[model samples]
Target: MASFDKKPTFAGLKLRLMNSWMFVAFFIGFFLFWEYSVLWFDIPLYILTPPSLIIENGAADLPRLLDYTLVTGTEVIIGYVLAVVLALPLGLAIAFSTILKRTIYPFIVCIEMVPKIAFAPLFISWLGFGLLPKVIIVFLVCFFPIVLNAILAFNSLSEELTLFSRSTGAGIWRTFFKVRLPAALPQCFVGFKYAAINATVGAAIAEFIGSDEGLGFYIQIVTGNMRPDLAFAGIFFLTLLGLCLFGLVTLAERLLIPWHISVRRN
Candidate 1:
């Protein structure tokens, strides 16, 4: 919670914004010091190229980088969409059905235990060398979070509320839609937060293994060529893409769960 000497005013907002800028200033200073160190210590340019070169190369790559960023972003979204679409029903099934809870849940965990990298080549073989494999990888990485969160959310609902609604003659569908689902949204979004971030990394990993496009592919080839500046460009774009998707998830949370109380400012 935020404390104040008195009631809120425009000055308070200004002060808050000013306080936020302090961190930005600190970051600027730290980077400046690091950049100077690269120049002063005669460091291998590749290991510690100043942000100047990073910015220049990154800007040079911006047009193409933006296009590639879109590809990765789309892969992340499609995979996450697929995960959400599949997770809810599957999770509810596992939660509500004894057989699924007993038999399916363990198998799901077993699949997650295997390193995704080990399976990337197999995914490429089966899906072929295209966007499909990366999409599948993203889906695989993101799917578990949603499933776990859904299972928890569904199970966490009040039994009394379910009983009361049933006693009041609500059907299962009605009860689930009105009570259980709305209650589960906060949990779903908590899952979404992790899923969103991991999906991007998953696509990057997939692209590193296969595919001819994407920032990951760029980084893979660039790093091998020992051009760290260009590699940094790829990384910069990766960070940009991740931030955009994370922002989307946060925005969706606001719209979908405004009553969540978690985001409400005091």
Candidate 2:
């Protein structure tokens, strides 16, 4: 019998490197260039701290940074979860019901039109410097996209799909779970990815306006104290947090809708 196993070839190695190692190589090269460029230009530490110093300072303050990260992460997770949980049902109702379409939809549109960041200060004042305000801000920022996408997803289902489900004697709930929900999920995930990005920003903006802890507050304090290196470190942490949240949403999309053409293309 012929053996089925094959050794890895140069082409396979090249493909793997191109797919995975390219990003790592680019990140390393970019930071290395940044570090040397700042040194070569004799850039003032206060104005533009090099990556080496940023890493050193951030590592030194890792414990406090982790605390701030936790605060912001909690706000983002809670608010994002709340938005997703509530928006789906509301979107479905709005898509199906004329009354909600006429009444609630217009109000939602008005809310979406207003700048979300402007509400941060008011939320702070109303809720005091608690976590609730930051969570609310995150919720507001995430809610609209999810709702709009859900409505679009539900409405975009073809009449033929519905008729086929009915022809099979599928009940409303069965059709929703088996046909409607699966068809809708790919589009819905687009909103989820968008909301995940916004959740971090909303929390940061809220913290910037008023809060005692969080990466945003930490950056503001360090910047005011003329510690640009520390500020950069805080910013780096904030970005990492956002990336982690976004990664979670992307992972969920992959898990829930692995058969989608968008997921398969990736």
- Count backbone clashes in candidate 1: 0
lDDT of 1 by residue, 1-266 (tens): 23222466999989987988989899999989978988899989766688888889878878888888888878888988999899878988998999999999989878768876677889988888688889889988889888988888888888788788878898888988999899888888888888888887899989988888888988888788777888888888888888888898898887777667775543
Worst 10 residues of 1 by lDDT: 1-10
Per-prediction TM-score to the true structure, in the order listed: 0.90, 0.92
The C-alpha RMSD in Å for every predicted model, in order, reads 3.6, 3.9
List lDDT for all candidates, in order: 0.84, 0.91
- Using lDDT as the measure, the top candidate is 2
Candidate 1 residues lying further than 4 Å off, grouped into runs, are: 1-12
